[model samples]
Target: MTKPLKASGFLGLATMMVVGLYQFTLLAGGNAVPGWMIGGHAHLGVISILAIVMGFAVPVIGVTGRLRTAVTGMFIAGQWGIPGVVWIGEGAELPFLMPTAFLWGICLIVSMLIMLYATLTQDSSGIGGEATGVTPADD
Candidate 1:
C-alpha cells in the first residue's frame, strides 16, 4: 500500500514537471493556456504531494491491513482521477466532467479524515504501541 502511494506520488510529480514545462512554453509563445488547465495542473501537484505524505503517515498512524488499503486506494484514486477528469473535460471540450471530478475530491478528503480520526481515537499508547499525542518536556 505504502509503496504504491509513494510511487504514484513520484509519478505524478514527474507528470507535473512535464506539463509545467509545456505550459511555460505555451506562455512564452504568447499562447494562453485555459484557466482550467492551469487549475488541473495545480491540483495534480497538490494531490501528488498529499499521496506521498499519506504514504508515510499510514504506517506511523498504524492504519494497517485492509483499512490501510482502502484509505491508500482512496488517496491514489483522487491523485489521478481529479485532474484527469479536468484535463479530459477541458481538453475535449466536454464540460460535464468538471462536476464529476468532485467525487474524486471527496475520496481524498475522506481518506484524510479517516487518518485524523484514527490518530485521535487511539489510546495514550496509540496504535502499534506508539505514542499518538505529544508529550511536553519536564519543566
Candidate 2:
C-alpha cells in the first residue's frame, strides 16, 4: 500500500492546498471564486481516486518496462494534467481546453482499462507464497 498511501497522501495535501488558496481568495477578494479553483477542487477528487486505484493495481499487476511507463504517464496526466489544463484555460481564458480535456479523458480511461485487465488476469502470488515457496494453490 506504499504507492497508494503516497498517491492518496499527495492528493490530500493538494486538496488542503486548494482549500487554503480558496480561503485566501474569499478573504482578499470577497466572494469571487475562479473557475479553475472550482475545477481543481472538483477534479482532484476523481483524479486522486484514480491515482490510488492505480497504485494498488501496480503491485498486483506487476507491470514492467514500457507498459509501466505508459500507464504511469496516462495516470499522471489524467490526475494532474487534465485538470491543470482546465485551471489554466479558465485563468487565461482559453477556449481550446475542451479538446485537451477529451484527450486526457481518453488517456485516463485507457489506462484504467489496462489496469483492470491486468489486475483481473494476472496470477496472484497468493497468501504467504513466499513462506510456502509455491504458486497459489487457489484464489
Q: Flag clash pairs in model 1.
A: none
> How much lDDT does each candidate structure score?
0.87, 0.68
Clashes of each: 0, 0
Please give the lDDT score for candidate 2. 0.68
Model 1 TM-score (2 dp): 0.85
* 1-139: candidate 2 lDDT, tens digit per residue: 3364346537745774776677687979767776676676668766776576667666656765666667777777777767767767777778687568888888888877776766666677741134755677686
Model 2 segments more than 4 A misplaced = 1-12, 27-29, 125-139
Off by over 4 Å in 1: 126-139
Q: lDDT (0-100) at residue 87 of candidate 2? A: 69
Q: Candidate 1 lDDT, tens digit per residue, 12-117? A: 9999889999999999999998887798899999889988888888887888777798898898988998999989988889888889788898988888888887
Give the true-structure RMSD of model 1: 4.8
